[model samples]
Target chain A: MSLAVQPIDDSETINPEAVRRDFPIFSGSTQPRRFHYLDHAATTPKPSAVINSISDCYAQCYAPIHRGLYPMAEQATSNYEHARRTLQHFIGAASPDELVFTRSATEAINMVASGWLKPRLERGDVVWVSRMEHHSNYLPWQLVCQEQQAQLRFIELTEDGQLDLDGTPELFAERTKFIAITHVSNVLGTENPVATLCTTAREYGIPVLVDAAQSVSHIELDVAEMCCDFLAFSAHKMFGPTGIGLLYGRQERLAEMAPLQVGGGMVDSVGDGMEESRWAAIPARFEAGSPDMPGAVGFAAAADYLSSLGHERVHRHIVSLTRLAAQRLMRIDGIRLLPHAGLPASGIVSFTHHNMHPHDMAQIAGEAGVAIRAGHHCAQPLLRRLGLTATARASFSVYNDESDIDALIDAIISAQRVFCE
Target chain B: MIAQDLYKETLLEHYRHPKNRCDGPIQDADAVERGANPRCGDEIEIGIFLQDENIRHVQFRGRGCAICIASASMLTEAVAGLSVAGTRILCEQMHDWFGDIEPAAGALLPNGLQALAAVRQHPARQKCVLLSWEALADAIDKAGRE
Candidate 1:
């Protein structure tokens, strides 16, 4: 029951037992069985603080924000604005004008693709993306590039799963208009050097978009430091409620992009003719329909939760667990893991069994109460580049410790027995 | 454990040594069809050689879970030397069985496929069990059209 993580170096490690207390799913009656969740890359379990914030908002002062003039509506509107500020502060954005609330990170990426890149992209221009992107980041650029008669280029990866950024300056030609890359790969857990990439792209007058959906939970993000023109992440991936995602754009860049949607709170004035309508300022122009008010509150609480548990400790905890898993898994007879052997990676460790299929392995693990992800992980192109159809991935969070890794190894052994023996 | 119940020894035997499984391209097949489960990345290709309006031979090639391979093996065994109509009827029976719908009385699954009834409990893996059957049906249709 003592889920104490071992320290990687002299730095203190996270006490998973204490962390689990904040998440209701792991506490006493909620999970009666010996369940070990290793699917943090999919979505993290919500903490009680986030759950309570959402419920309290609806129970106490639920109202449609930015529309009503009543006291309750004003209070709710104030709370909604406060949530925006919390997220703005969380990512160290220079101003609240930079953030827009959207449906999910996928939608945020689409917004950038359709609104910003589609108009600016000229024929024969190029957009660069790494091979390791989740479909959310890759598909948007593909569609926009196809629409504009522009070319989409892929940044190759080294054999060890790191982005091949060698000769970075040489990679971008005059035709290179933009680059969008992930802060961390959801499958390989490789922490890409987005800051370095952004700095290099800046010299070429190429803007960068960092898909932070996988990194926001495990890594500290500062858009100012990253120098990315745009950033996107989902709150649900970081112990927050679903249906709310944050899109952080530079003030100057956002002013240049057209709004993806129109109507309601996003408009300042309307006329009989279509071109006569005037749009609201910056972030509001991008946010059209009624927002998820309670979701914003819960998102802020989740942001606060991550801030409370400093990113340094969280990063160390996950890296240690993932490294331990990768080492242990490679010791198994037929298991082959992705390289740099997941060391110094964020939190996920994916592998393939020479003799067993990923689905069979995942099913055995699930039956043994060890939850892992097994599939292409929505990164088929990356999987294809790796010459893999699927992989069994065990991802870690603050609430997981070495016992979860043990459970995973045991599940792999069970699968080998069922299929190989 | 659900693992033991679902991956029984007979199913494991079929998975370990699947019948009529070929590698590379089948140059002599009369018809071929491939089925893929996009969610799980399981893929199966069913190839059939027909003679006198009957399936004289059947083979499958692909990578998938134990359930999928075993089901494909059982299907090949059950459809050997059967007419196209018989194979079509067997595919219908399998669809009903995998759907958890009770079949008509005395219309039972043949070739020890009844042992795989445990797969019906898992909705996700049911696709794995049915992938080959669906591909086989398509292959038969392709052969008919030709």
Candidate 2:
């Protein structure tokens, strides 16, 4: 297998055989030693290409972006800006200026919560959010509302793990400032109609923020198409560095919001005296002090890697694996399948055995060298509605194949034997 | 009392064939306590019959990894006739006997119960290994109060 190097969505696309070649660890597995990685929703294993890119950024052209005038600094600055541009195009933004770098999507949402929305959200304002968002997306809004005396309303999720679109229209009102939602559920593998939802929110003149952490890696995303006010996602899910993530807000929205972290680099001028600290431009204004340089560089390489491999293919691969995983998991006793819709699921299949705890199941699976995830998966409110405290989740990715799903299926049966009948 | 080796085999046998995995409807029971391993979401409902602070009978009705249920099985055999104080001491001995924690430790598998010794190496499975016994101890401690 060779590495892919094509652009996004050409009919004569790059084959995954070429892409899978780059992930060396996916091959050569023994019985219990098999690295059955079905936990991509938590974090993806890095590709050698992205790992080398990080090494190169650190070893060769390590310098502060937007700080030094030296050649290495210039290279670092260019690499960092290239990553921003890659994200700009990847998410279908109008300009690179619309993309701002943050440590992770958590920080990005916190930036909006603390810096941008905090000062502006008025008391008694209604902020709507779905019950299905990760804690990172849900908690920040609650904190902001608590601080501002604004009310946080939860838009009900249907039994199928989707917001009731029928009920959703009732949720939007003149007072509904914004609706925060996850583009795809990390736990349920349910893909929300984000673009349509955002479009509907537009009619009511409500700003919508989307948490795309789970969707970005395995989906074809376009911020422009999605019509969101703000889109946030982590880079690590896409085979990039951990601490790097993207926050894509419309240019006008970015201008209206204040920066979260205020420090040296973000200021245009510190004032001659000690009186005032004027802020820099829109993107720079939001980015305070030094940023993760190598992270950004590796993120660019990752963006390049995903684009070259084609996200559409990746999405297809994962969706097919999800179907296979569900079919196999359903065969085992004590597992029930959620009614996932016709659209492509991100990469998660959450099921519980009748007499098995997810963690114990996951641990037994772990002993078999299968890495699956267990818990509320940061969707406790939804889990509570499902009458569950947690679930064992098998998430698929570009690296996963039928064999991996088979491994999981086998591990699950073994767990049943080990724990139950 | 049965040989220690007999108890070990009993533990392994019950581990392979867990007893009373489900408990429902009207039933006579001694003590019942909910055991949850928060780490892995493994929950066990331990039901025991006690007479004179000794385990008169024991049964489990819950979900978890093998070790938890197996340990529950081992627990039933290990402390069936022991007094309350003796039961606690045995639990401590088992915990201590896991490794150098029990210095000058000799041959293991005190029979079917021997598989439990491997459990110490896998920390994640520790909670499963101790779930029933811990719940049993707590249940016995609260049996009179409740």
lDDT tens readout by residue for model 2, A326-389: 8777777778765463232667888887776677678777767789998888776777667777
lDDT of 1 by residue, A1-421 (tens): 0012223344467788888888888866866786899999999999998999999999999999999999999999989998998888888899999999999999999999999999999999999999999999999999999999999988989989899987354467898998999999989989998998898888778899999999999898899999899999999999999889999999999999899999889999998866688899989999999878999999998888887777889988899889999999989999999766547478999999999999899999999999999999999889999988889898899889888989999999988888887
Q: Give the TM-score of candidate 1.
A: 0.95
Alpha carbon lDDT at A285, candidate 1: 96
Clash count, candidate 2:
10
**For model 2, what is the alpha-carbon lDDT of residue B77?**
69
- DockQ comparisons of all candidates to the true complex: 0.69, 0.23
Tell me the docking grade of candidate 2: acceptable
Q: Under CAPRI classification, how is model 1 graded?
A: medium
Quantify all predictions' global Cα lDDT against the true fold.
Answer: 0.88, 0.76
Backbone clashes for every candidate come to 0, 10
Per-residue lDDT over B12-78 for candidate 1, one digit per residue giving the tens place of the 0 to 100 score: 9999999999878766899999999887778899999888979899998988889999999888888
